[model samples]
Target: MRLVIARCSVDYAGRLSAHLPLATRLLMVKGDGSLLIHSDGGSYKPLNWMSPPCTLEVGVPDDDAREAGVDAVWTVTHKKTADRLTVSIHEVLHDSEHELGVDPGLQKDGVESHLQKLLAEQIERLGDGYRLVRREYMTAIGPVDILATDADGASVAVELKRRGDIDGVEQLTRYLELMNRDPLLAPVQGVFAAQEIKPQARTLAEDRGIRCVVLDYDDMRGVDSGVPTLF
Candidate 1:
């Protein structure tokens, strides 16, 4: 990871064009050759970025840019798309790089898979007559956390998340889009199931016609143990 704090401006041109005025910001050049610009706010999201499968070229500023107080120019070009980003740096406040070892992927808390298993076994918690078709239902994009049938025998694509977010809804949307193309699974419905769902995520799910269901972990465990549901 290469981290740089500098007074810079950014402009992107290609599929779309965007501009960021000069300001002190963090510039992240990742090991994969992607780049991200972040302001102090916006949670973990970056203000601008170029995803990997891209290249970055650095050059000295031209006379016009130099006259504008720009010292360096970084141009990033995407490999699979006609996207380009240019960053102009006036001053480098800080710069450093670190070698982060190869990632083995994320370390789960085990809470997610556990929730999925309990939900699959207690499929009826979704509604009366709902039955599990399969866990990790396979599709071209990826697995749908759970594939099940509603009382009417309609296909239900359930995405299990520890905390449901808009991205999760978007993921299930893609799965449903692809699954519905199949003659066998056409017209699949989506259920955004999670232990807790943010209000914005819930709104987006509903707006997208996906049902949202909040699960009770303790209650589910009790049900799995042969204890009755508290209701």
Candidate 2:
């Protein structure tokens, strides 16, 4: 992991354009090659970022950039796309690198964790004859939220999120890709289950032949027990 604190201006060019004026911010270049720029304060969210599978180039600013007050520049280009992010540093306040090795990922808790537990208990919510095999099913990449079998006995991998976004779809896609390679789970299917799925995410999931399920947390919690059902 590489961390840098610098007074920099940022610009992104790809499907969209964004600019960040010169300011002191934390620059994170993750193990996966993703890069993030964060201001001094904000809940973990980066002011700007470039997703993984990108190349990074660092060098002194060119004549044009030098004249514009850019002391150094970092360019990140996505491997599979033309998306680019450039950070023009006016001055670096601090810089350090650490060999953190592979991260174990996050341990979710609170409402999200409880929600996953409840969903595991209510496997039938998936559909008739659906049975949960296990929660936090271990995989080489990471643990899947829930593993289940559909009526036809095919494996089903479910990814739970509070709000389903494009990234959630991507995550599920990766899990499904890995899971499907196993002979035992050769024909696995994927489900993006969340309280509310964004339209864009739903479209992406569907495009990949994955299903999207909208969860009603209140009902899942038995908050409206008076509303009886056939379940």
Candidate 3:
């Protein structure tokens, strides 16, 4: 990974337009060919980012850019959407790269882990005619909680959360975006399943055309009734 702290301005041109005025910020260039721009605040979320399946080009500023005090330019273009994120560097405070190897990935807590297992065992909870493809379906970014097929045999990616929130929705969105780029799963659908879902997260998921499912843990576990089967 390459990390740079610099004074720069950013412009994004694609489905929408956005700009960040000149300021000192952190630029993260990950090994996966993704770029993320972060400010001093905003917690873990990047101020702006471009997902992978992209390219990055570094070039010296032209005459106009040089006269305006720009030192360098970094252009990141998305391969699929052709979205562009351009960063005009004014001054570099620090630059470094690290050799962080492959990650082990996040370990789900007990409840969440069990939820994934139960959901896989009872895949039809998603709806009738649903079939389980696999659990922990691997992707370039990370593992999706569950992968399945609906009645029409369309690919379905399920992200399981103990308490669904905006972050979980965003995670599922990224997974769907990556999966849809594959020819075998070009039209993958997404499901955000949790024991409880926040209204805001549900709104966001629906807005993105993702389905939201509320799971009943006790019922699935046979705690509410004598029968252990989902049916």
Candidate 4:
């Protein structure tokens, strides 16, 4: 009834003997608190590979399984202490809760960094122009989350939000206008990358050729596109 990870046997045709994805791999924890070693193929050897089949208790028994006038039984049991396997996945990136630190302002900075990391992962996979500009870009408006570019190599100023809000559209619009009209900055598209996207803001973005992306944390694990869109 307990779990452990060790060299176990399995029938060649058993379900667990099939190949599995590497991402699904996790450290196997055992009942005795020891870890199991993974095979060269990145799989655990099957429980019945080299061991005898699991014994079963059936309705009738043969002479070898009987005693006196009563029918004998054969029940499955582990041959050794290290036969169970349990897996646990480790997070590759820090969670938001880990952002708090000794310095209050640094805590805010940490939160931003975590959010940026999530966004960066998405941008990398979706393709280019996502750069983490400093908070120094914040004017009377708000902090700029990114300066993203679109497929056409057009720059796009971005504003990031931990969660979607009404102000994101307005803030991004102001930045977009500034960046598009000002000669100092490129005439770019606009986008707001956040955990969620408001319907109204999405409509507005489409109307202005601004790209608003709802960057779910689950989708940000890879690289990006080269275009930077402005929001």
**Best lDDT among the predictions, by candidate number:** 3
Could you give candidate 2's per-residue lDDT for residues 5-91 as a string of tens digits? 999999999999999998999999988899999987898999999998899999888899899888899999998888999999998
Clashing pairs in 1: none
Per-residue lDDT tens digits of candidate 4, residues 28-56? 33333333324446355622222332222
- Candidate 3 at 35: error in angstroms? 0.4
- Give the distance in Å from residue 156's predicted Cα in candidate 4 to where it truly belongs: 1.2
In model 1, which runs have C-alpha deviations exceeding 4 angstroms?
A: 107-112, 116-215, 220-231
Better structure of 3 and 4 per TM-score: 3
TM-score of each: 0.56, 0.51, 0.53, 0.41
TM for candidate 4 is: 0.41
Candidate 4 at 6: error in angstroms?
A: 60
Best by TM-score: 1
Each model's backbone clash number: 0, 0, 0, 39
Q: Candidate 4, 49: how far from true, in Å?
A: 69
lDDT of each: 0.94, 0.92, 0.95, 0.48
